[model samples]
Target chain A: MTERADCRASTVSYAAGMLREQLLSPTPVDLRAFLMRALRPRDCLVQVGGLAEVSYHGRAASTAEVGSYLVMIKRDGSLQIHTPKGVKPMNWQPKTDEITAVLEEEQCVLLASRRSPVELVRVTFLEVQMAQALELNEEAGFLLTGSEAQMQETLAAHPELIEPGLRVLNRELLVESGGIDLYAQDAQGRFVVVELKRGRATQDAVSQLGRYVASVQRVVGTGVVRGILAAPSITGPARKELEGRGLEFVEVNALPLVEKRTSQPSLF
Target chain B: MTERADCRASTVSYAAGMLREQLLSPTPVDLRAFLMRALRPRDCLVQVGGLAEVSYHGRAASTAEVGSYLVMIKRDGSLQIHTPKGVKPMNWQPKTDEITAVLEEEQCVLLASRRSPVELVRVTFLEVQMAQALELNEEAGFLLTGSEAQMQETLAAHPELIEPGLRVLNRELLVESGGIDLYAQDAQGRFVVVELKRGRATQDAVSQLGRYVASVQRVVGTGVVRGILAAPSITGPARKELEGRGLEFVEVNALPLVEKRTSQPSLF
Candidate 1:
């Protein structure tokens, strides 16, 4: 049965990525066929539940006794086995050189290995209860944000918090297209353009900062201006965009100062 | 597409044990009813998949951004969230005093708390994909074994390997019913009765040793005979049985000496 306690909350996450890759058929023939396909090298994540026996044969050898477990093969060529008892996987191997699966008799056998030092591991699945293979895309499909107006004000009050030896020169300074969040000067006397987001930032925010910096550069010369985007976190694509343009990212967790007396209380 | 490699084998396990535990029905009403059941305190293991936003509100206040994850609540009042990318749980709390689930506006809210330091974790599940809860029974329903006969020879040649100063007096020494694996004398010079098992030892093996020790005790007039069970592993019931009978368990991994040149090769 169960016990009762006050319903407090804890840290948790949700799933959103689309299931674009393989959906498992849960048979050795299907697994062999899937694994024997061309080596396209797309990101892959596989989960299978069954009886497994894992053994490694390299410089040092070790084997785990057989038991039912959830085996995961990640896209980065890493493998892990999760038991029912705890959070940590009962066994795991780091990213490696190669991973292959095949059918022998009615059983599914997986072989993973690394070169140079020559390490190898084999996993045998006696019976599969559930199996799924997913391909992960590095793109974040959703965005979470807070009040940008309040975020700019907070960082305006504490420019040094954004970067040491920085001071705000203007807030909402008008340019040709729109108003910049905060125009500032860096410690090295460089004109620094700052854009702040209360929550997760995206490529649109980065592009805005880049335009602001370009505007300042037109007046102060190209090499005299710097661009920085400050936010609690940023999406993967936004990070890539910032890196490509040689811009900087500063963390600003204080933007969400107002937890919105709006919105209903959370359910679990 | 999948790549090809030589299909070697690794350590794996299979599932057993009757589904004596609870089988879950996914619904707020059902979860509330199940969680509000009597405090029977049977071992519980739960697995739920969905979008979740986890936040901890205690001395160290923290919150994880919303994402998809697997949430696990274990029998001992422990809770964990597993992400898809790695072997470690993204977030976890140790054994706690209470864990409760309730529905608010169709959202499932979980509150888990510990008393001493007064730490609490709150998890809100916006949607549920796959959810199941099963009671974990410690009794292992199956067994694994090795070469018992070979194990006896390995230990006989190296009795000190079992315990320091242990010397074998005889192999398969006869008793009232049958033969003991190894008859030895300890560093203390008391008579020792040893039972050998190649793979996993069970309650039956422990009982056999108990009988042997009693036999030797009757012949030697009590308090002078010690019983030992040697095997690669032992079942949970056998472990409890050994402890209750005041017996010893020794490591004997040499059993499955012949990996059965029989049986077809593994499938995954």
Candidate 2:
């Protein structure tokens, strides 16, 4: 199902379970009010793209050269302004910064400021190609886990779950390129390099394992060295690459049930 | 200093310490090779926007409707496809997934796949508005410290750092609306609500602290309750908001030097 709305200054469309409002013209618009209305439920993403000129005044005054810019505002009021290309934004208002939006007839401006050290970013939109607000479901309690370490610890305690006679040699073995998750040996006495992922394994993991396997094989000789990718699941492309490279994949769950059980004293 | 290069199919320009490569034509171009070359050092961001139609065929076969799409590729091979207004990507390849780019006469395609689950995402560029690659500096050894928690611990250990006679009553005090980082009593015996940030405090933090202060004030009576925002630094906007609302700002460093000193064994 799809729903769409159009105002004098913008077009709002909903399709494929997403609500999007796009402003195409250079008309004067109340950006803050528009954002408040569009970002209903307070957890959407606001993206502004166009030519921008930024100036900072107070501690010291400086003007940034005009350029095409992309500004992303998170639901938490944190926002960043990025130039055409780069990993980091040229200027940013971290999540803790206060943001105020000012809309005028000629242009729209966003002010992000903090007082003690006196930092402020004044973003002036010269021409706004697009100002869009996308509705997103609030993700609940997305906890960050120390998964790789947890997986290694789990496997070390329960090596048999991986395969019979598989023995863990060491954890986090540093190689020239990167660190190997686990160094191990199988029942056949052949050296094995194990790569663990806390979640579903992807093609990059396969490639990484492949590189480590190649490096280890060079030192251990091709016939005696083997590689294994350990994760809860593997993607199709990753599995294809694994089998094609003569490597193996094992599903390893990283629940700390053993640790929990060991930490609790038995009532008996 | 700035530099620029242009080919029949694309134009590359550098200005304001940023390198920008853009392809404006409707004609087919080898986007993969262009990306591989432009993203030299392999740690840049690739953003493709305009119109996109994606098809997935492998374990499950489905085709996405043609629409304006934004595709972001990170340095670590993670990519996400977003419609103009969604917080989550319509399709995504996690960082662990392997990505391959293929350029054809009619279209430029990117394939992200995983082997075990037999998953694949084939993104076909129907119309390219803008394709850009920007250079970024390599960040070295970025450490993640639990700064907020550390700050709370530090202040609890050394309340004198914040102000004389400031006694921490409790940590993570739950209020009606939000949790106050620290609940304390000032030297004047006023109920002080503290909000702590490990890094620079922004305007949002001030707003949040205001909310907490208001909630606590209702119970303690307005004149008796006070708000204090503590962080490593404060931005101008945040400070302005702090002053406007009659709140206090305090700088707190979270190096854990005190904890380190106490944890060490005596050399004597």
Candidate 3:
């Protein structure tokens, strides 16, 4: 009996260990106190699974039916409501919006309001299941420096990299649908709609190029309007789509143009 | 000339005001030094527009084509790559991974590595057009407490709230596709599949309910399986879909089930 009890105790601790590092309560009595302690000035994601009624008053008034909710609060005071699927949030308020949480006798309510747009969102929790606070570390990932304009400039300076006979005509040429990255002429004098990507080109990029080609063809009439997708690389799916669409793909390497300043004295 | 200069000056400051409140640099000389200064322990979002190549060596070896990239660094050391559109990132590294940034004479490189599965990601920036960092403030949003399990349990205990003669037969009944939240028999003795949403029901939720009903009907063979979507409220589009599909919608209010203990002594 003692051995069985010891085994059970160890299992409980093991389970606790998995969650205890990030969570404070196995079960909390005061929901407000828990939130006050858990919520920090950084990013926090809260998942609620119970009855929740969300009411929003904005351009047009609407209220969400009571259901489970996932709430994400960015460090900049912006908040968004998410369902299980889809990239866009079911509902959201901008970073400038203000939010406050109030704990009543047996319910916890959160109120978010925006001034300029005059929007209000009120979320009421009928039952408390789990509440966890996580501190978001922003600098722990990659920071990139560069822009598409720089890439475009670099590519334009070296049109030979695209094809031997390709001659550049205009950059950011205005069309009906959108701006074409580059307008060029091929060796055969066929108008080429060049779509430049700073990274691996995806299927969407190919489709975008197709749209540009179609738009240009509509305006250019009889002259064969060819489409060319230029990037460092292209994905397999994107390549397949490009082939199917009879579009040409060219690999353009973005080499550093400026000479390294090795002669400079090390400040660090 | 003075008026022209004043207009130009105001325009410059106006553009500066638009970016300066969140970003420190009008233009930075050294990308690494700027990142070292801009990257804090909190959440920061960095967008770069130039030639960038991302290489990943992990369970599967792959590389991203050189292109403009949006790198988001969470406070937890996790990072994600975002393209111009799409809800999900092109690639991502989890918090458990380690990241390092190296500044070369003419290039800025970011390396992220993980051990357990053995993964490595290298992002090389050929040119930096724009790099801006914004500090995240987490406490500005709402914090919620609740769980779906509790809502399910409550509704199961009070089946009468759903309908007059509705009786809950089983909770989480396993079907071919997935588990039904609640299976019940209505007043007409017809089998009913109850899909409970703790918040506002969207079109996706209704579709999910429809799937459950279809799966139940396929299994029950002849007994008239009906789907009932129960939530605090339903969206206009969701209601329209529900009506078109001939499904019933019920609003279930999430009221506090327990009374408040006001007599207790306050402890802060």
TM-score for chain B of each model, two decimals: 0.42, 0.47, 0.53
What is the Cα-based TM-score of model 2? 0.34
User: Which 10 successive residues of model 3 chain A have the least lDDT summed?
Assistant: A11-20
lDDT, residue B110, model 3: 67
Residues B136-207, model 2: lDDT tens digits? 332322222345776688788888888899999989999765578899998999989999987788766776
* Complex DockQ, candidate 2: 0.01
TM-score of each: 0.42, 0.34, 0.38
A1-268, model 3: which lDDT tens digit per residue? 3432232222111111111112211222344555454444444333233346676665434566665454545445566654332334456776435666776556677677888767777777664433443322222233332345666787688787888888999999987556799899988899999998876788668767876887898899988999999887999867876887799999875434335459875322
Better of 2 and 3 by TM-score: 3
Best by DockQ: 1
Candidates in descending TM-score order: 1, 3, 2
Q: Lowest summed-lDDT stretch of 10 residues in model 2 chain A? A: A1-10
Candidate 1 segments exceeding 4 Å error = A1-27, A31-45, A57-61, A115-119, A134-268, B1-44, B57-61, B75-77, B134-268
Compared with the real two-chain complex, what DockQ does model 1 have?
0.03
Candidate maximizing TM-score:
1
lDDT of 3 at A186: 83
Model 3 Cα lDDT, one tens digit per residue, B144-243: 3234566788889988888999999999998754679999999999999999887788866776787678778878898798899988899986787688
